[model samples]
Target: MILAAGRGMRMRPLTDTTPKPLLQLRGKPLMQWSLEALARGGFDRLVINTAWLGEQIGERFADWPQQHPGADLRFSHEGQDFGYALETAGGISRALPLLGEVFWVLAGDVYAPDFLFSRESVERFVASDRLAHLWLVPNPPHNPRGDFGITADGLALNQAEQKYTYSTIGLYHRALFEQPWCDVVPGNPQGTAVPLAPLLRKAMDAGLVSAELYTGPWTDVGTPERLAELQVD
Candidate 1:
């Protein structure tokens, strides 16, 4: 599932007209890079949840299924009913039926042209007892503080001096978003607004989350300047 529903508040004026995911990096929509990676990684089906300017996203990528070999695109339309995005957890809950027992989640706005969505990685995650497996990257200039900490044993922790930014790409087991651990109601058929971080933190406390440090070509693409830099490079 690709989380493309964000309003891109940091992206401002540029995003006013174009959804962040639709913003181009080197003449291609940012989300398209993720699509190609998924395709190369052997993923055939994908669910993209959208809200602001979502119709445009649907229209643009509607043909991805036919364009990318073995790829099938499905949209979890949050705007049709909610008129706004159901935050990450909410959106995933709403799309659970499509996601099944476990799924890969990626942020649509990030620019990780070299990130490979490997089948072996998925198989490893699926075989683990962990509820979530996150890829953490070295802190970029914009977010120097970073997000989560990883232990020697590869467990994700909330507090640690040495932390890494979450790549926003992860393997998630459905149990992390279901009852007992999660209380956020699903957002499809109906809609709800819920953040994803708190849910992850809760799971972390239970030692249900695992993580790995990823040193790769990646950019958050959170601002117009960063987009411009990518375009220039």
Candidate 2:
């Protein structure tokens, strides 16, 4: 699942006319990079959640499936369904029917051209008892405090001396969005907005979440300056 429903409040004037995911990085839209990467990685079925100026997203990729051959590209229109962007967990819950028992998710607004979505990684995560496996990166200047810490055995930590930023790339099991782990109903019938961090933190406390360091070319691309930096690079 590709999360592209953010309002991109920080990316003002640019996002005023264009959704952040559609903003150009070099010559291609930022979300296109992720889409291409996923297709290359053998992930043929993709669900993109869209909200702000979502019509443009649908129109932009209308012929994507034809272009990609076997690839199945579908959209979860949160704006149309709920009238707003449901936060991470809410969006995922709403799209649960389209996802499999286990799925890969990444933020559309990030830039990680070199990242590989390997089948081997998926196999490993599927074989584990963990509910979620996140890829953590070194803290960028904008987020020095980082998001979560990793133990020597690979379990994620809620609080630790050393922490890393969550790259927003992860493998998640359906169980995380059901039962005691989460209260949001499948499809989020009420459209209650929810973030993923709290659920991750809870799972971390139960030793149900794992993570690994991702030392790769990555940028959150949350600001114009960051996008500009990528262009300069």
Candidate 3:
């Protein structure tokens, strides 16, 4: 599941018309590169959740490559920051049905290679039964607020350290969202805003979450300068 719908207020002018995922890095659309990587990772079917500028994104994949032929492609349009975007956890919660039991989720704006394997990685973490398994990168200088969890070979945290940070990318199991949920609807009326961080903290305290520090290049392209840096890399 690609988390593609965001206001990208940080990206202002560039994102005025184009959604952040559609913004190009190097020469291709940010998501196109991601799609190519997913293809390499052996992901055929994809469910993208979109809110802002969703039409153009849908159009780009209309003629999407044949590399992953017979690939089932579906788009869940969440065009409403006021009408459909369910924040982070809220968005996933609403789309859980479409995502199936355990699913891989990534932010559409990030461009990384070999992020997912050529085939599905071992289904190690249980979403319905256990805490989600997150792929975390070392806390970058920009985001000093590091989120971390140390467990006995599990994604569940043991030590209650508030210093380490969490990564935005993860493979989620769907049950930690059962209680203490957030607002899910417009105006957040009957809404759910279950952000991943606090949830991780809760699960960590229970020794239900696990983490792996990614030693690869993962950039949070929230700013134009970072986006520009990504473009040249």
Candidate 4:
């Protein structure tokens, strides 16, 4: 599922009018770039998860199947941000049904990048018993502390001190979210913190995880300047 519903506080005026995924770069919306990559990768069925200004973003594809005939594109509109925006895992929890057993999970903020990233990278995970397949990128300055550490064997490491930077884009299975999906305590304002790295690492340590690292062109456009910079490419 394409994650498109973030409230991009860092994206300022651009997000003021359009959702971050809809922000233009290289002559197309960011999510459009991701969609195109998915299409190129032979995936036609797509489910996008959205929240803030959900209607406007959903309206962009009011007749998506017609615009991109033969493609099965659908949207899941998350309700208003009454208190705090749903955390990453929370968003995934809410849309678990739409995603099914195995599907792609991607960040909307990143510009048009190689979605396939390296089918080999994902193949290892897909072949394993892991609940999720993660794409780990080299550490960048923005996330100096990183999130998940990786060994040469591609096993994920847990640490109290150091962590590896993980690209949010990934492939996930239903088992990982079963607990969150069924056990959510209604009216609990403090949402569950479902971090992608820790969960994947646990699966790895237990031999139920799968992962790979890619040195390809990947960008996490969390800031306005990075968003603006991608436009020139």
* Every candidate's lDDT: 0.88, 0.95, 0.69, 0.70
- Poorest 10 consecutive residues by lDDT, candidate 2: 223-232
How much is the lDDT of residue 76 in candidate 4? Answer: 61
The sequence of per-residue lDDT tens digits that candidate 2 reaches over residues 14-52 is 999899999998999999999999988999999999999
Best by lDDT: 2
Clashes of each: 0, 0, 25, 2
RMSD values, in order shown: 1.2, 0.6, 3.4, 3.5
List model 3 lDDT by residue over 146-222, tens digit each. 66655546454545464344546677666655554323432233445456566667776766666676777777778
Looking at candidate 1, what is the lDDT of residue 220?
A: 91
| TM-score for predicted model 4 compared with the true structure | 0.84
Model 4 lDDT tens row, 1-233: 88887889888877887888888777777778888887777677888867778777788877777877789877766644333345566667666656667778888777537657445645665677767777778777798888776666666665525565778778877677665333443322345534454555566666555556777777888888887667675
- In model 3, the runs with Cα more than 4 Å from the true position are 65-67, 80-84, 118-120, 126-129, 152-164, 179-194
